[model samples]
Target: MANHNDRSGEIVLAEDKAVMAKAAEWLREGRGVALSTVTRTWGSSPRPPGSLMAMNDQGRFIGSVSGGCIEEELIDRYRQGELADTLPLSLGFGVDNQEAGRLGLPCGGRLQITVEHLNSVTSIDQLLNRIDHGELVARQVDLGNGEVRLLTGDGHPELSVSDQSLTKVFGSAWQLLLIGDGQLARYLARMARMLDYRVTICDPRETFTDPDPLPDVDYTRQMPDDAVRNIAARPRTAVVTLAHDPKQDDMALLEALESNAFYIGALGSTRSAAKRHDRLAKMGCSPQQLERIRGPAGVSIGSKRPPEIALSIMAEITATRNRTAGVAAT
Candidate 1:
């Protein structure tokens, strides 16, 4: 396999939607490749367990495992074709004082990484296909033989590594729905994309126009309720209404409050939130459902600018997604 020179110094994210696809593509093109995953992390590791990266014989790679030093070491070894001959094997870094210092590992941090040599692209291609189609699948790699098993459905933890094998769940990208295309929405959409969310902006008003539109986010002119229904709300979806207009925001909230969406938020003040709740109650929303909508949405950051508001909103959404329970200060 010939080494490709494109993107010579770029560091790609394994968390992005493209890693598995890119891995499959590299294999199909006859490159000698290996997939590396952070199997376990102990104490403040840079990347968490389940983080993935793939390296080829040319030292070209995508994804990250640590604070660059680990990646460089792995790349150097792979460049010398050291990893391609192995059945799946585990490599540990930062076990002791000297090793931690040498590897630039954060103090007291250690990581266990598994590297799997690839000879066939079929499994990767299948994994990519299923996730792209919105299915949850688990990839199990036998530690002794490098054999891979792809299982559909859930019940597996995000990452599990036993003595015999390692299993990691792969799912469709998380989705974010914004009920407006205003400046606040634009900033939120941009930030959400950075977090690997498939963001969509829905605005039904024909009179509304964005002076600048961000790329890679979908736009729809469908009514907010219709948009929610069509998106098929799931546990990985979040809905935020930034339209400001009561009619538009309330319509989105009605459907969002009832759906499987993991997070639902709206922009407004405390008084405005109370008034909106009354409207929702008259509209037949139950108390429980009303509680799901985080109005005056976002942690109170005293944000007065559009960007800061967007940041707080995204932070709140992330907290909800991670199930970080607390008496919300906002």
Candidate 2:
């Protein structure tokens, strides 16, 4: 939850993965590690709820729960053994105007943080493995006894803490399915990867050659419709057709519309979009399905260049995803 400045939702999730992985590594090395999480925030706090930070007995740390002095105070307390007896400690900062200024909180911001001492490397390793394998898991920590357990999560609830326990949900990264192979597709794939989306490009044209093959992306020469069907649709999936050719684009769109993809888009001019819609209608697409497709693909940014157009598309996707995730506007 460190300031991401217009990045997509998965970027924050990726940061969470990194911080937890680092904590697991520190514990494996026989070092004492403490994990701190922001349980709640109020009024202009730099970090939001569920933000994480990890510290070692050697004063080494990774991640950020806040932008300023709050982390320093937590580290000092850990090193001084003030938190030794308390297996799980809940602390609040910036409760008053004076305290807010002292803790470097913006305005009269306040934060509730839960700190836990991590002593079992095996347990942390198991949790990290589950996440890496794309499982939706919930980690529950009992404040009274410092007991930790991992349970299958439903993947909808946000992180929450009660007087007795803290519950945090972890899931797989979001996915992007692009039905094209071109300069525009390349740019969009690169940007999407940086935003932490797992990108896959499907194009059946034998003439299509990847100009720059991204390491993380999956490229397939299979037919777009077949590929889309294989990928299926999930709530975290977004499908975009950029091939322009109706044979390919329409085929992919038809399959994508039948799935549960959260966003379905096609790139084209106004006339071209209308023509595509008419063709789909004749092909027996429902009115409800047609309504889900966003013609021209992106926000009206008046961008003519490939990179700018890609940025516009990603911006719109980010906005749509945030709205779906129930994130509040700053």
Candidate 3:
């Protein structure tokens, strides 16, 4: 499940973000803090480029750059004042095969790390605020002085470093809008949340109820169409209809089709999908717009079980996300 750019599990990324937030909090409290980032990697490094780790003056740390292998050493260096300067230092690990083996790097894997001694609590607070409000921001750091600047970011590389400076982009967290509260929707919501997607379930029907409500997910009684419109559209947003009832699914699909959501899907059979397409067309949807709805809602995995179906759906969404990123990069 690991992505090419980072670890596979969304929970890991969530933890990394939490670490960044904590680091900012510590800085605001006037404590010395250092942020270590994986700037580059080669030959099977456990962490990918742009992975983050943060530590405070108290020697407490969060997140990871080499899983559990290199963190303690970094902390020890910081505590000894070897990294107390205001400038950023680029350090390398696992460059030697024997050292790599001793450090538990996989097969001589190497990582280029940038450690920044942060002194600007105001900048850190602003960056954290921007991220909390769903802004994609690029942080540019001067390697010589440790000065930082935050800029609005479009689609760009997440991390780029040169001899003089380092620049990294942070995007808003992904979100998922589910149009049903059925068993299948429950499984999908759980999976999506594990992937770091902010999940919201919308259903006006009183028939759907869960004894164990999901943590951090918003369950709304708003009608599907109204909910979709209220959420609006974003490039990282995804909308899915698992209600199987036309009255709910169709209205939601119509609104979602017009939004900026990157992925829109509905659950149904081939015949039902065709009928829904026709109905949408009759409602004035263009041919190209109609094609945006991914009927059957997943890759063909021949899944009959709820969890299996949920996996297929997430797989398709991941594929779509990767493809979109590729296009944006080009």
Candidate that would win on lDDT: 2
lDDT on C-alpha atoms for all candidate structures: 0.80, 0.81, 0.80
Displacement of the residue 219 alpha carbon in candidate 1, Å? 1.7
Superior by lDDT: candidate 2 or candidate 3: 2
Model 2 alpha-carbon miss at residue 242, Å: 0.5
Candidate 1 backbone collisions, by pair: none
Worst 10 residues of 2 by lDDT: 4-13
Per-residue lDDT of 1-330 in model 1, one digit per residue for the tens? 122222434545556335566677788888888888887778878887778888777767877777555787888888877665679878998756676677666667788898888877888888878887888787888888888899964555567778888887788667899998888888999999988788999999899777777889899999999998777465578999888889999999998877878899988899999999999999999999999999989999886899999999999999887662111110
Query: Which model is ahead, 1 or 2, in terms of TM-score?
Result: 2
Q: Model 1, residue 66: displacement in angstroms?
A: 0.9
Q: For model 2, how does the per-residue alpha-carbon lDDT over 217-278 read when each residue is reduced to its tens digit?
A: 99988898888887755567888999879999999999988987778889888899999999
The segments of candidate 2 whose C-alpha lies over 4 angstroms from its true place after superposition are: 1-14, 84-87, 95-109, 143-145, 158-165, 327-330
Local accuracy of candidate 3 as per-residue lDDT tens digits, 238-289: 8999987899999999999888788998988899999999999999999999
Best by the TM-score measure = 2
